[model samples]
Target: EEPYVAVVYSDYLHLVCSSCFHEDAPLLIRKCKEAPLEACKGCHEVYYCGSACQQNDWKIHEAECKFLSTAVAVPSDIVRMIARLLIRRKRGDHDTFRAYNGRKFDDLMDHRSDFENMGANFDKVFNDTKNYVSIDYMVDREEIVRYVGKLLVNQFAIRGPVDTCIGNGLYIGICIFDHSCQPDLTRRSIGSKMILRSQNREQTLNKNLTVSYISPLACTEERRKLLRSNPFFFHCKCRKCEDTEQDGYARSIKCESCEGGICLVKDDSAPLRCMKCGITSSITHEEANKWNADVAIVEYFGSEDCALFIRKSMHIFSPPNMRDLAKKQS
Candidate 1:
């Protein structure tokens, strides 16, 4: 049977080596035979294979390590323990005696008493180093449980797994960029490290733009629908969604003043407002092309330029033929 896998959403707790962009040294330890004689002298948490690798990485690693160490504030030992537990849980090599579905996973975890000893050890460590370690802050219990459950189901505990090659569950911080119909981010995997690259030529983005982890290839309506149903409960009120012209293709509404050219905003109380003119007028579905001609074009183009072209052509001149527009965009 194929092993269960979990997709861990990236967060902000991981430390990456500057020299190699490696997420964790313990994961790298598998690749190297000899351990460094001395750990990172300042941040005792991160060890190295040798002084050469450490020295080579000092310039970038030092600043990032200092910032991370200060911000995270948790003890290295505790974090390592959590990581080990995750790794152990991911290594499920024995025959699938049981299905290990979500129900079974919950049942096993409900037997918290089985792992009570480990909890005791945690408490002991916390009590012993009360001054050195910060324990007052509350962690999201559900997040930890979900992650630990993933680790156990994946059997990362036993090691030798391809997914565990870089150690999963650790959150590496990446700069946030705003969502767009056309996104600039690209994911590249090098060994165990997943690198996010900016496909755009510009090195810096504007201040007003918001950053998002998800892809922006989806249509405005589809994106809105996803935002509504997603765990993150918030409607996306982006400029794209506000465009009545685009909504016309979704069979939303049409403006009477502009004939078939302008689309109307859909609201029971709000009258149909022409997108081109500020005229408040309504039209029937028969008057306008009930089907969206631009949607197919936008889907084929899959880029900001295509969206811009469609918006301009529809609003200004005649709406382009879907086939010709789609081919050009593609």
Candidate 2:
């Protein structure tokens, strides 16, 4: 699938082939050609393996050349990405580019109101966009803001074969897949392209495919917090997000009544009920905060003794609590 717009990060300008976005390695770089990489005569901001590669990307880069040539410094990854998108939209690229299901670029979701409610955060982005993008390429102020919000929420990290992030891109089809903490599909990247595959035989017949937008290893609450921030400003209603009992088990407290653990009950303000012994235990806010802090310290510091001490204090949820396993092995 072709990307609607993509830009290699500034830090990787020289290392990656801007046109093909081939991985940076001696052998791979040599595979393209031993000839020294060429920089755009106008901007010197992008690099290509050879003239042919440069020519291939020239269509998109042509619009950016003039702006980049006169700029004081190279724009940021997101900034450059947004500029390319704006240029494409102004030139009517959105009308011709379609997803697998024939969804046009204009069909993409735009959370303009959400960004508007963001106040100063949204203001900074809008101002930065205006500063970098030339006046000729820009649309009305509201239209630019709408595109900015759309790109923020829909852009994907262009990662290389080894799973190293090389750039950012906007793919119309990939954007259609919704986010889930527990996804039914697996995704891998090759250069500027992404490949999604069903995880199991059952998933092949499934209609509602999903992929993790955030790290699945993170606790449910942490994942939810991230999903509700900057790029994704919506609460998740995935199976994992709705599993309140499972979430409580992850942060369970020790129950003194039956030497069992008591998990926090979702949507209930009363005392927690022990999952094992059916006894109620009242815990203070301070206690919960302390437990969370201790877990964080052990995870960050990787002190085996500290982990063991914490492990003995509660009934840890299995598998996801790999730290406990490591502590036990230690």
Candidate 3:
């Protein structure tokens, strides 16, 4: 008796489970020899050898089942071409199984004119802002070209079944969102299904708001640098990035004399007047000069070292319990 087999189509080939081929003719036809006649109970599109094999593969297949079910049957010619591409990559000296990064395969073939227009529009937007934007003129053009080409190729090769089942749906309008150092939105993926949600305190999204896809750990300067360098072509003037003068350091400072909050400037000449208490005390010119020198020395020691020193300094000046509370807040 031969071992039972299970076969399914994905990416560029019909995947067959090597150990699952069985001797029973009808069972073989229903399981490994071709597309499964009986779909998995939960996601009724995937075929398995039996209840046992389905149970075993459930963990891996559950997430992808919905996506797989929605894929339209590829034409025999297209499937063959894709299979050849995969085989050539396996046999060739160079790596050819590169992932596609651009438009969907179905979309690219059906909407070539739309993509060309989009590309032209993107270029026009970039060119219009040349005066205000300080773009990195020496970016590697080859990398951009390669990325775009891969995207187009992938778009043509991978046609989702949902294309036919689902109506002629418009593409998700996410291009307008400019990059931000601290984005308000977060994205979650369950298998191939993507869900976007608000991560910030706001309950409702405002008009003209754009969603972000990047992590928000980056500081303002790093975010701006990315925006300037990327194909997105827009300098982020978001509130967090633009308000450099009000960085986290200024919010952390507390007055030693009255325990009142004080906002300090980078230069450390005289602390800004406290809004809570109307008193403004001026640091003498000598003291200001010394403070600037100290800041330079602290910065030279590196940020992590400087932060540790500041924590120790705070502990020396403040109550022990207060230091614990500050650490907790941080």
- Candidate topping TM-score: 2
lDDT, each prediction: 0.39, 0.69, 0.35
C-alpha lDDT of candidate 1 relative to the true structure: 0.39
**Whose lDDT is higher: candidate 1's or candidate 2's?**
2
The best-first sequence of candidates by TM-score reads 2, 3, 1
Worst 10 residues of 1 by lDDT: 1-10
Q: Is candidate 2 or candidate 3 better by TM-score?
A: 2
Once fitted onto the true fold, the runs of candidate 1 whose alpha carbons sit more than 4 angstroms away are 1-85, 88-171, 178-200, 205-217, 246-330
Put the candidates in lDDT order, highest first: 2, 1, 3
List the RMSD of every prediction in angstroms: 17.7, 7.6, 19.0
TM-score of 1: 0.29
As a whole number from 0 to 100, the lDDT of residue 49 in candidate 3 is 52
Better of 2 and 3 by lDDT: 2
Error of 2 at 130 (Å): 3.6
TM-score of each: 0.29, 0.71, 0.30
User: Residue by residue across 1-330, what tens digits does model 2's lDDT show?
Assistant: 567788888888988888878855655534467766788887988898888888988888887888788788887777788788888877787888787767777888887777667762555656777888888887666776777777888888877644467888888887888899767665555656666766365555233778878665455667788999877898988876799766555555666576435555343455666667877666653455355445534422335655665567445332334334344233
Clashes of each: 17, 0, 13
